[model samples]
Target: MEFLAVVMLAVFTAGYLVLAGADIGVGMLLPWLGRDQDERRLVIASFAPFFLGNEVWLVSAAGIVAGAFPGLEHTLIEGLYPLVVMLLAGWVMRDMGLWLRGRVDAPRWRGWCDGAIVAGSWALALAWASVLGSLLVSAMSGGTGLNAGTVLGLPLAALFAWHGAGFARWRLPEDLAARAARVPVRYAVSGAVLVAVAVAAGSGLSWSDAAAEGSALSMTAVTTAAVLPLLMAAQGLVWWTFRGRVESPSYL
Candidate 1:
């Protein structure tokens, strides 16, 4: 059960890093990827279909931590409270921008929305990097200073941007794709590498000691086993449905 819980947690976390990373990266590079409003819309349309679905992975990972590894959850929440708050704030801001951008159809409103998307995306990336950096540092050095891990935040954020550029090259239209491809990296390869590194760094943590026991572990393991297949199936369906290059703006 403990092993199952750890595997599930790793799977969900890696899934989010690889899947939602593209969404956040694209949003982070929206201004560069899309020079004008129409272009921006097209760029956004590229990843819109997958963003919400990708978020499910993050939620599942969180649920796993809370249910199957309550000790780790408490430690993270206590140690990384500020970063968590930043993550939530950025998530809300980015989603609000995406959901509201098309509603007004006004230049000013859209501009604000665009700014929100960019800012929120950046915030999310930085916060995630900081959290990961902190964890990596703690695991490596046996220390718990929040500022110690922040040194890696900028570099990790750059990795996120690179990952986004790769995604853009694959999803955008010909002209935009050409622009995005200038970054010179393969999307799948970079994403895989990113996920691998994150998982490896996380593997250094003391998960066995932090995991829940007894009923809590059993319940979480069972629940994860039941839901994971459905989640993967749904994700596959969505990806298949929108596999083609996005030619125009989406409802986003």
Candidate 2:
């Protein structure tokens, strides 16, 4: 029963990662999305279409956390004080940016809101990735597993910021894409390393555990083998296909 529930929760978590993750990636790259005023307008419009609905997964995830695992809620939230705060704060900032973009009058003023949206979205991405990385790197030991209990800290967050930079690569105007890409490319490299380390840790845990209970490790390996390369290739193709094109988001 517990196992089934956890597995379901993990699946839900993955769904959130794919959808909301892309949404964040889009925002992080927004400032770079266009070369000229028209392109930038299109970039902004790309977000405008689906901005509000993209976060439904988040709400669903929270409901699952609060309702499904009520017992773990207090402990999880209390122990991860800073992370929870940042998560909510980032959410607020990003959402506020979306709202304020509409209400504000001037183009220059709204541009500031767009900046906030990008910063908040990417900041949230880094924070989330770091916590997940810490979870992977923490020492996994015997009876209580207190070592694994703590979330991954700054190093992982830095890694996330790095990969997020990679996601920025294609989002900008053709000219800026290469320039803005330097940071995200580095970020992606670091994030890839962190994810690799996490995989290694899981493999080690699977080998050492007496009862062979590391289903999480098994699933992670299977998913990584199946998914990561495909995503890399797909993203590359996307970049190649759209290389010099302006933001005609009608195709999106």
Candidate 3:
């Protein structure tokens, strides 16, 4: 039952990470990708359908963590309280930016909304990475502060940017799409390499250690090792299958 619960938690985490990463990436890239007000609206429209849905995954992941691993939750809340607060604040700002950016009439207000979106998204990403870093380090070393885990934020954010760019390329028109696709390839390559290195180095413990015992961390490591490749493959296939500009006149 614990194994099953952990597996479910991983699934929820992946869902939230991938979907929200892309959603946040769009916001992060908006200033650079969009040349004008109309272009910006198009970028926003492309992600509107999935924005709220993506966030649902996050809520689900949190619930799973709180319910299934209360000890872990307590540790995280205790160690990374400030980051948790920032993450919530970032989410609120990003959500408000999404909603109000469209409703307000002034160009200045739209700019402010755009700024909020970018800032909020980056803050959420950094906070998440830092928290995860704190969790991993604390678990392994009995340490109570940030370490290499905190540095994972950059690559993780880049990964999200890559996912967002791929999404934008698939959904947006011509020049915008091409531009989006070009930038993310670099980010994708760098993010993947850096993230892999970070995870491997930070964990310190070997695969054999994880397999030797049946503890929660061990099961998580084993499950992650087994499932991550499959998930990446699935994500690759999905991207390949959907790779191309949509012919629709409207964003769905």
Among these predictions, the greatest lDDT belongs to: 1
- Models ranked on TM-score: 1, 3, 2
Encode model 1's per-residue lDDT on 1-252: one tens digit a residue.
Answer: 898888898899999989999889999999999998889989989999899998888998999999998988877777788999999999999999998999997889999999999999999999888888887777688745475876675468777888999999989999999988889888898789778768856866778888887799979988898888888898999999999789978887
lDDT of 1 at 63: 91
TM-score of 2: 0.59
lDDT comparing candidate 2 with the true structure:
0.53
**Candidate 2 structure quality by residue, lDDT tens digits, 1-252:** 333434444544554555456557666666655554445555655435444444664575455555445444554456556766787788788878867765756878777777778788877876666545444554344221223433544444444434434544545456655655556364345444644544433332322222213354345334544554665465456445545434554322
lDDT against the true structure, each candidate: 0.87, 0.53, 0.66
Show pairs that collide, candidate 1. Answer: none
User: Candidate 1: global Cα-lDDT?
Assistant: 0.87
User: Candidates' TM-scores?
Assistant: 0.96, 0.59, 0.72
Identify the candidate with maximal TM-score. Answer: 1
Candidate 3 clash pair list:
none
RMSD per model, one decimal: 1.3, 7.8, 6.1
